[model samples]
Target: MQATFLIYSFLYLIVLIFLLPFEYFKRPASLRKRWIREKFGFFKKNEQIETFKPKIWIHAVSVGEVVAVSRLIKELSSKCEIILSTITDTGQKIANDRFKNYNVKVIYIPFDIPFAINKALKHFKPLAVILTETELWPNLIRIASKKMPVILVNGRMSDKSFNGYSKIKFFMKPLLKRLTLLCVQEEQYKERFFNLGAEEQKIHITGNMKFDIELREIHFPWENAIAQPVILAGSTHEPEEEIILDAFLKLNITGSLIIAPRHPERFQAVETLIKRKISESSREISFSKLTEMPSAFSFKSSTSVVLVDQMGILGSLYRICDIAIIGGSFIAHGGQNPLEPAYWRKPIICGPFMYNFPFIEEFLNHEACIMIDKASLLEILKELAENSELRQTIGNRAYQLFLNKSGATEKTLRLIEKVIP
Candidate 1:
């Protein structure tokens, strides 16, 4: 092994060993054994790939990445068998659910330790490995690149990520060089990759695959169950829920509030917080869970607040909502996707910290959505709730922008075709 690879591998194993206990215990009891087994590169006999056609291994870190690359995976499935690996349990579940029909095998990504990575690579023997966004696992790239093409699709580099990577340029440069191609989301990401020691010729601006989101005509029973105008706070995090709940309570007009937190593990915590906050308040807002929708649940005459304890339904829920308050922005968590609501032609609201998504600037320039501070959230919510005309105008603009920004998936697929072994 190269000296840099040796050093990184050693350090990575040491860290993994130290954190194994915490990582193992933090998972739910149901997933503990499977998580540990998959992390160490063990797979069932049926999970093994034995395709006559070429096999492609694609790694997406979480739900966002998995969703971003879903279309590409579908396109590739017709050409090659796919081994789709993800790090988070949610990502694994969604990937499995999304590609169950396609020629794709969804599994947890092996621990970055050399032994696990080698075991995985030897077993799958993929023709090419594609990583979504900024997943630059050193051992995985270094080892896999020597055997097969390792490409990065829909790549991006945030300011924080660039600064941290720059500090370790000596270590990162070699890994970046080893990547057969880097298909970035924008010109800024291409420039960042160039600065971080990736050859300029190797980086291509293929646009963001997330832009080419395939919005389905999904109909859930909640579509007709709720009578009040719904304020869906999609993908909310810790303190953002508090802010959203407070803002919803202050709205003059009556409306239901839906809080869909980013992580499923935090569902109970957010539900408890919502119940406590509603109990402490003066208004009569009924609380309920989304799983009871369409049958067991009924919206109270007064304002109703619902906690989304389910997954894979937020995008569909966007169609039923009046206004969408994006989460993760208010507290510098770098905002979730705003395009889902934009696709449904719903007025969107987010905070000022959307650096993770550089394309959000275009929305701001066009005044397609409302980006405000935490203190201004209630004020903005009140205005949107009261003004139907204003909501329609903003929602229309956002849908137009979304329509204009598609075709990224086609662009990325053409580039991948060139590198496929």
Candidate 2:
């Protein structure tokens, strides 16, 4: 078993080295330096650590996972020092900026190699390591398990991932065995992991921690800045923006619309798309990016749509908007978080492809959110706009579900304390 593992590790290392130049050069200049630093595990934050001291290590790969685990980290911060690591630049930025208020040491996690993992483990001698959602690193799990319990929190195994792992089930057994426990989102996900060589006894269904998110009341400047109710289409992908524009045009009500694309790189692309849509229409309308003005800023009489090109303000926008059209759902990208809008008592319109968000089913069934064909988006928007009471009914149902599902984070905390406390 050890021999086979070593062979696989060596091959993985070869692939990593082969792709180094391609990956390194592709990053923008601002992030290239950080990439270089992470490659050597030379993060400035770990410089002060000279010896083995007990801390908690939480690894989240990107913005979505990072946001999902925000409340978990907050509750755990008071109990122990935390070393948070993220793979993407945007996730790293949020980790550093948001977690600075707590006992968190944010750093970019190095690639999954023995040397890099060893360096990170040496600096922060954690009592336990918590990996968030589908972050199954073979070497890191195996090595860390030998020192302390390594738990997979809010674990999920999609059908696509399960099929991939089942093909390599023989080699995956050793890796799965190393994990102390699997706290999964649902029973189906736990069963999927078990079928993929995970020990049935080691997996527990803890539900999704994202449902237990702490919703903060943020006063958005745009909320008071505009004269009419705002419709926000947040975390949108490619053609989703165009769909939103077409639907808003169908709405008989007069209100400002904000479209925030999911990827930072697509901000310019969405802006261009929106401008073209505005110009093609016969009616005169105004447009601007959210970064252009403050809360006190007023829109021109003809101003209608605004593009939120900036990051870290989506939550605030959710608090202010009357209706939310979550991005990624309208396309094949699964779905973005519906809980964000639900927390603010706002009705949501999601696309049919919501496989990524298994939890949204309850909201849909309870009439907290509505899912329609992209073609029917116009009809739904028009109906909701005409009947204020129908919109309120959807929002109320979703908010009630959000309240009922508020205990996942607390449940996860108990499991963590059981292992590490």
Candidate 3:
């Protein structure tokens, strides 16, 4: 164990040192110092807690994982003192805003080095560690597990990840065995974990926590500002936007179109692409940013294309739109979550590549959602736009499926209660 750790530490330090300059320069000027300090296990505030409850450390890697466990954190907050750590700056921002009222201390995760991990563990002094999804930091897991439980909640293994991890099963087995318990999303994930050296007895299929998300009732100005028959191309990637925009133009719909790119860094580039495309077209399509419009502004007779530049509002956009187009699937990128739109009973459509979301297969089997190719996108959109009854039928089916899969959170919490103490 010592030898493996030594080799791992050597390789890890080398890579970290190599990437330090690139990572430092990539961050905004104001956040560079804070990001560097936090990653090295230095925190600004040190306070004492008066509560007698056991302290738990929860780590989520990024936005998706953070949002998946939002409600779980809320429920756990009242039960214990919580130290929530996230890797990405965006995830940290969302967690802070989402859990501002709760007793959660949001911070950046420490680098996976012995000294850094030791500092974090000593400072937090948590009784147990709850990790979201597939965050398998070797040093953190190995060290923390020696003292307390290191549990994985809402765990899943995609085909891509499974193939990659399978190649290094020798290295993964020790880390997987160190985990006291694994609460996975599905039966397949349990099988995958077992194959990767997690003890079968220690792994449990607890369903996905995302199904139990407590959606906020958002009231945004876009709700009233946008025109009717609105089509939302949500969580879109590169070429998908171009395809959607071209399809909308060909369909010549007289309603609003909202394109929400997946990454915040791409907002300006997407806006430029939209403007260039609109300028070249002969049609009188107007384009604007969602942030710039007044609360009560109305679109003219021609078609309107609005770019969503903000973060954490995709759920609200899904609620107001008439038809939803799931992005990322159009390209090789796996699809985004469809549950948000399903929660609002919105008719959903996506491309063929949805391997990231294995549960989507069930939706397709039940006829709950529509899956189309790039060539057929225009036809499907036009059909759904014209046929209100078809849209309602599909939306109702998706909503029913969503309700049927709602108890994962309660099951996971019950399992956590058994081991947390």
Candidate 4:
């Protein structure tokens, strides 16, 4: 099984090298040696290696996974030298920022190629490799398991991902067996992992670490900060933004609309859409140029939209929002994390495609959230925005739900401690 995995890894490496030109042209900065060293598995000789031996290596694929496992990292840092690795630039930045004060080293996980993965493992020499969510790198898992224990923390297996993995059951069965322990987010996820060849004795329901994140009070210092009741369309995709803008336009209330796109590259696109739509509206105002101080309710009826062109602020923005419309659901991206807004005690509105978050969907169905199909979003937003009492009622229910689900972090940490030798 290991030999076959190595052969596959070698073939995958050849494919990656063959497609290097395309990746280089698409993102030259991303493929730079220094950037690759930091973001990918490539390491630099000049870069100083930490003197302290890292006891555990934690891998989070991107920003969402990083945010999901951050609290657990904090807890594990005290007893172990945590080595954090990410696949994206944004995830690396967040990991570095969050772990700067701790005894943690942040690096990019190398390609799943055998040589790259082996090189990284030999250098880091961690006691265990801890992967967040579903980052199942075949070569990495196979090689690391031969040297040190590999554990999956805060694991979640969506039905879609499960079906995809099940097709390659023969290849993944051994990979799943390499995991020393599997700390999953939910029992449903445990069952999914079991179906995918995970050892049932190794699986534990640790709950969702996202529910474990500590909600910090956000203070927006902008002069024309959104003071009046605001509705945030967070992590919206291309067509979803237009839909949200249209819904906000038909709303009966005089409040601000904040649109936060999921990807940073989409910032400009979202900004352009906001400009075009607001220009056509009769009483539209953009908050991007709000430079001067204004009374709390002064710009209540003035600014119609605020495009959050920055990243890492959406979670904070949710704290002050009266209602939240989670994006990606309407357009079939399986939806962004609705738990972020739910933590703020704000009433959430999402489209129908929420299979990625089955537990959240179940909670919403039980009145923990407000579900709106694409066709009904406009009417629901209009109703919620017009009635402050109704918004508050739902918001309070969502907040309670968030509080009820708050112990996942602690539960996850306990499992990590038990496995992290």
Candidate lDDT scores, in order, read 0.88, 0.83, 0.88, 0.78
Q: Which stretches of candidate 1 lie over 4 Å from their true place?
A: none
The lDDT of model 4 is: 0.78
**Tens digit per residue, CA lDDT, model 1, 1-421:** 3887788778888898899999999888998998898899888777787769889999999999999999999999999999999988899888888888999998889999788888888888789999989999998998898888999999999999999999999888888999999999999999999998898898998888887777667777555667567899999989899988887887756778989999998999998999999888887778888887765456775688889999877887898899999899998889999989999999999999888888888998898999999999989988888888999999999999998988888988888888884
Which pairs of residues collide in model 1? Answer: none
Model 4 Cα lDDT, one tens digit per residue, 53-159: 55688999988898888887888888778778887777877788777898788887887876678777767778889898899888788889888788998888877
Please report how far candidate 4 places residue 280 from its true position, in Å.
1.8
TM-score of 3: 0.97
Best-to-worst TM-score order = 1, 3, 2, 4
Report the Cα RMSD per candidate. 1.4, 2.0, 1.5, 2.6
Q: List the residue pairs that clash in candidate 3.
A: none
Residues 228-301 of candidate 3 have per-residue lDDT tens digits of 78899999999899999999888876777899998888999999999999988888887888788787776664
* TM-scores for every candidate against the unseen true structure: 0.97, 0.94, 0.97, 0.92
CA lDDT of 113 in candidate 2? 77
Show model 4 residue runs off by greater than 4 Å: 25-31, 38-40, 45-49, 223-227, 289-301
Residue 275 miss distance in model 4 (angstroms): 0.9
lDDT of 2 by residue, 1-421 (tens): 7887688789988998899898888778988987877766666653543444458899999888888899999888877778888887788877777787888887777788788888878767788889998999887888899999999998988777888999999888878988887899898998888887888987988888888776567676656766456788989988889988987866646777889888788889888998998888776676888888676777775448989988877876788777889889987888888888888888999999888888888887777899998999888877776677887888889989988887777788888777885
